[model samples]
Target chain A: MITRVDHIGIACRDLAASIAFYERTYGFSVFHQEVNEQQGVKEAMLRINGTDDGGSTYLQLLEPLHAESPIAKFLERNGEGVHHVAFGTADVVAETEAITGTGVRALYEQPRHGTFGSSINFLHPKDCQGILTELVQSPVHE
Target chain B: MITRVDHIGIACRDLAASIAFYERTYGFSVFHQEVNEQQGVKEAMLRINGTDDGGSTYLQLLEPLHAESPIAKFLERNGEGVHHVAFGTADVVAETEAITGTGVRALYEQPRHGTFGSSINFLHPKDCQGILTELVQSPVHE
Candidate 1:
């Protein structure tokens, strides 16, 4: 159901600083940046390497827009660090249905809009051995 | 200096069970399995996708071999979840020196043996935004 590691989500106290750190330290550059009000995060996607095949992975730096944002809550509890691991899928809805059919719970009843116009949903961390897992389906160009 | 995400290291209480979970749920197959005495863990590398161009990413499941193992310590505090993010590099020694020249501390003075005959070293988590970061250099065939 899953393709590759889509991206690694990191909860950052300061998005700009985190982006700068990765850029200066590792020579990674931001590929995309946007604010997702629904997810309550201002995020920047840093290309890990120079691959434009659309299969390259990214480091997603997320900064909460408000105190009540999920990223804020994660930062409050865990401090600034890796938040979730995302798996790439061709069809997130189908993958969610297949996994949930096996007794794993999906966080959303329907697919939700995600970064880069993707569809995304989370699996319950309890069912995923305490790791927050996200399935991401890239936006269709048609 | 990093080329790509080498792998995501996950600390698991039961290596077999974790490996089974990925295989059954995601159709990911184990590419390699080994007991690294120096690292004090039994680990299995699961290929995240079918791409084998030496750039394919992996999910590394690690279970501690003994109580004193670092994986055991991480499991004690964080439970079964992601442990660290590893970046692939061409020369771990040179990368370490370059990174440390900027005042970031390395966990070791020299590159140490890693899984699959790779040389590896770690950057102090405090310097890495609370995320344990590893640099891995693939062995060269001469």
Candidate 2:
């Protein structure tokens, strides 16, 4: 069900600063950016390399937009680091159901909108060790 | 200097159980397994798709072998989660020096032997926004 690693989500206090560091150190440039009010995060997506086959992974820099945001709480506790690892899939609903049926609890009842027009959902971290896992179904399958 | 994310190191309490979960759920199979006496942990490396280009990423599951091991302390404090993110590079010595030039301290003075004969070194999490970053120069550059 999991096709490839979509992006590694990183929670930071300053989005621009983290972006600057990555760009400066590794020559990675931002490819997309958006604000998700539901998730309460200002996020920037940077592709490591522009590959058409969807083979290249991404670094997702996230900044909390408000104090009550979940990411804000994560930053307060963990400071700034990798927040989650997202896996890419071709079919979100089938993939999500397959994992959840195996006694793994799904974080949401329905799929939600994600970056790059992908459908996304979270798998409970308790089942997957302590790593928060996100399943994303890309709209454009490369 | 980084080319791509090689793998995400996950420190877990039970290597076999964690390996089973990943293999069963995501179809991730173990590509290599070994016990590193230096790190004091039994580790397993799983290739996401068994690709040869090194574009595909990996998951390194680690289980502490001794009470004094660093992974033991990490598991005790943070539970089973990401320990570090390893980035692939062409030159470990040059990449290590470049990152440290920005006042980001290297965790070790010398590169250490890593899985797949890669030369590896770490950047202090304190300097890298709470993320322990590993610079890995794979011997068989794909």
- On a 0 to 1 TM-score scale, where does candidate 1 land against the true structure? 0.95
Can you tell me which runs of candidate 1 are displaced by over 4 Å?
A: A50-54, A140-142, B50-53, B140-142
Model 2 lDDT per residue over A35-137, tens place: 9988899999988632324555788999999999889999888889999999877888898899988888889999998887779999989888988999988
Report the Cα lDDT for residue B10, model 2: 95
Give a tens-digit lDDT track for model 1, residues A1-142.
7777888999999999998888877778999999999999999999774222356678999999999999999999999888999988888999999999877899999999998899999999899878899999987411
lDDT of 1 at B22: 84
Q: Can you give the TM-score per candidate against the true fold?
A: 0.95, 0.94
Pairs that clash in candidate 1: none
Off by over 4 Å in 2: A49-53, B50-55
Question: Across all candidates, what is each one's fraction of true contacts kept?
Answer: 0.52, 0.52
Give the lowest summed-lDDT range of ten residues in model 1 chain B.
B47-56
lDDT of each: 0.87, 0.84
Residue A99 lDDT in candidate 1? 90
The count of backbone overlaps in candidate 1 is 0
